[model samples]
Target: MKGNSSSLRVSLRLLSAGLVSEEVIKDDTKLVGGSGLSLCDSNDNSKKSETNKALRNHQVLLAAHLEEAAELAAMIQGLSWALKLVVKSIQFFCDDDSIILDYVTDKVAPPNESIVVAKLLKQLALLQTSLTSCQTLPLQRSDDDINSSSLIKLARDAIASQTTWHTNTEEYETCPDCYAHVSPRHKLEVRSGYFHPICFTCIRD
Candidate 1:
């Protein structure tokens, strides 16, 4: 899905692995990057109605090693945003088979060190019952499809923008992958006295 902030126009095209790709239009414009987002502290009431306000607050950060965890975070982020927009039903297309799907759908336990994964799993559990309808399906990770090709370019542009942002900003605590600023809420503890702030999009890439 693609949304333009200036126009409040949203268009859906295709999806995979918790990310939505929209057909680029003449007026396609980028949404504001890095708004506030919080995951674990949200309540059911907040999920149902306060998503915009909540997202305007903090970004959730994960470890560099936790790709599945990041995908889960992106799934939560997309679902919460859709709910905020009052979307009734949702279809998610994932590019590949992922253990994260099993974790969310089957209640499979993550590794003991996967604290972020565990938290995201719990969040997905709450979300599954909250939505009217939601489906997660797989798509072949190939550029043969037009939608897939657009999605790949979108991903590359995002990565480029992130790299540009990092290059122009002053050095501080940042995500190792994207180099975006890492707030306290954006960090996930990976090991003893170690913290890495990896955003979901970067992790997905």
Candidate 2:
């Protein structure tokens, strides 16, 4: 995720030695978390040319109103996945967000509660202790590096293949048309098919 937005896409890579594993994680306020991993190994010199396909794309959801919060949440989720894969050192590469980057790298205290949840702060603290190295760096958009561009394409492709869920919970519901969270206070309209809820913005449009 990037800029002053509520939701965006994330690209993550797991690099071990010279081998690389990749994933595109999509973020939204209305979704939940799911991820997978793929590992590649060389068994024969002749098979070294073969590549292991990237693993499953991830969908991470958080109850956030700012893109910074969503971005931090994505980092947390990605770190958790890395830990599961027995990775002890991690370096995060994200769009320039100095405040969040400083907090993640321990250059400063926790960020504001509004931009970073208190609960998530605690989670990040714990994750930090679990890893030997957890550092953050600004992503480089350079001619020599095509990783960022490729990851963006991967994210778009993943989104095209998936459909949003239209369901209701006690606190919030998802608008079938826009796929944004519909808070209880927002006026909702019930559509004919499956009785899915639609938000006023979608209704107006």
Candidate 3:
């Protein structure tokens, strides 16, 4: 797929063998997911409806990895969902070289391949159809990077809990630029720790 420098960037980190964390950082603000946190942690019943609405609008699937290659498969699944959420193109970063090669280079799978490989291929196809342009690259191995370390911590939490973390409506925050309270759909974040909500208006601007 073609690469667009203006497209939103999403960082996908494999926390553990079975856990993954996805994050978008914008203007010093961070939006995090796949932490396995509940959405309805609040006691107010009035907000429950709002939370539900958010849940329906922003959905992130959390699944446990059963096979060795499940992490790559899960990443592909995440990309497929992201394509539906954002209008502009998206760039995905992950540390797995094998998975990157599998998707970027159209390699034919041998007969009797593992089920995880098959699933990855299927999700990759879906992602291609949904995105106008996409790019997947390897993540820099850096222990000092705050974003990288934070994602690792989130993944550790998910693995310890042994559960899948889905999108919760309450997780949405107001975009700093648009001043509208919405889910994390189409948000933008920078490597310098800047984060803001991205709406159609902001994207156009």
TM-score of each: 0.47, 0.44, 0.41
lDDT of 1 by residue, 154-191 (tens): 43333323322223534334454555555434545433
**After TM-score superposition, what is the CA distance of residue 143 in candidate 2 from its true location, in Å?**
6.3
lDDT of each candidate versus the true structure: 0.43, 0.43, 0.38
Best by TM-score: 1
lDDT of 2 by residue, 1-205 (tens): 1112111111223311111112121234323222222111212111111111222223113334344444455456556656655656655555554466566556677545453345555676788688777665665447214444344334333332232433454355455567566563574665654223467998788
User: What is the alpha-carbon lDDT for the whole of candidate 2?
Assistant: 0.43
Runs of candidate 2 exceeding 4 Å displacement: 1-64, 107-116, 143-145, 154-205
**RMSD (Cα, Å) of model 3:** 17.3
* Candidate 3 positional error at 194, Å: 32
lDDT per residue as tens, model 3, 8-83: 2432222212233333322233223332111110122111110001111122222222332444444554554444
Off by over 4 Å in 3: 1-68, 96-100, 107-111, 143-145, 161-205
List where candidate 1 sits over 4 angstroms from the true fold: 1-64, 140-145, 165-205
Q: Each model's RMSD to truth, in Å?
A: 14.4, 13.6, 17.3
